[model samples]
Target: WLIKNYDYDLIKFLQWTCATPMKLIGKQLTIIDEQDMICLENDYSQCQPSQNSSIIK
Candidate 1:
């Protein structure tokens, strides 16, 4: 709820919380684009909006 309501950068949050710790142990981290990000629930929900796609905000 905080994430959706706050002016926070999701990508930065992932990098700091997930990627940074893994990199310290020599793990390769790939940065994904915003367009590739999707919020799913039970592998069926899509939360990102696209112009050419059918996903609605």
Candidate 2:
């Protein structure tokens, strides 16, 4: 619905759905790659979930 109504892309969707909700409760998240490399929000598309990649608090 957001994609159609608000023209949200993947990054915006994640920020609104994940980060925004977390912020509402005072929590946060960090995405890491397979090598434990931190994935910045600008590179959110590269943070695909795998056996090693993770979303941490």
Candidate 3:
């Protein structure tokens, strides 16, 4: 909405957002708080599960 609702002066806003952390899809998220710092964190399960071939035996 920022791009559409705002005028041509939003260039800075766009730049700042690029620096901030971003929330990823599927149990992962990275975001920056009001303090303007980068924060990265995600659920342990978000990582791709490893296959256990031994269990198939």
Best by TM-score: 1
lDDT tens string, model 3, 1-57? 655777534544453434423333232123423343323455333333333323544
What TM-scores do the predictions have? Answer: 0.22, 0.20, 0.20
Per candidate, the number of residue pairs that clash is 0, 0, 1
Worst 10 residues of 2 by lDDT: 19-28
Off by over 4 Å in 1: 1-10, 15-30, 43-57
Q: Per-residue error at 6 for model 2, in Å? A: 17
- Per residue, candidate 2 scores C-alpha lDDT tens digits across 1-57 of 644666334545354343332212332234322233223566555433344446789
Candidate 2: which pairs clash?
none
Q: How far does residue 28 in candidate 1 sit from its true spot (Å)? A: 5.7
TM accuracy, model 1: 0.22
Better of 1 and 2 by TM-score: 1
For model 1, the run of ten residues with the poorest summed lDDT: 42-51
**CA error at residue 43 for candidate 2, angstroms:** 21
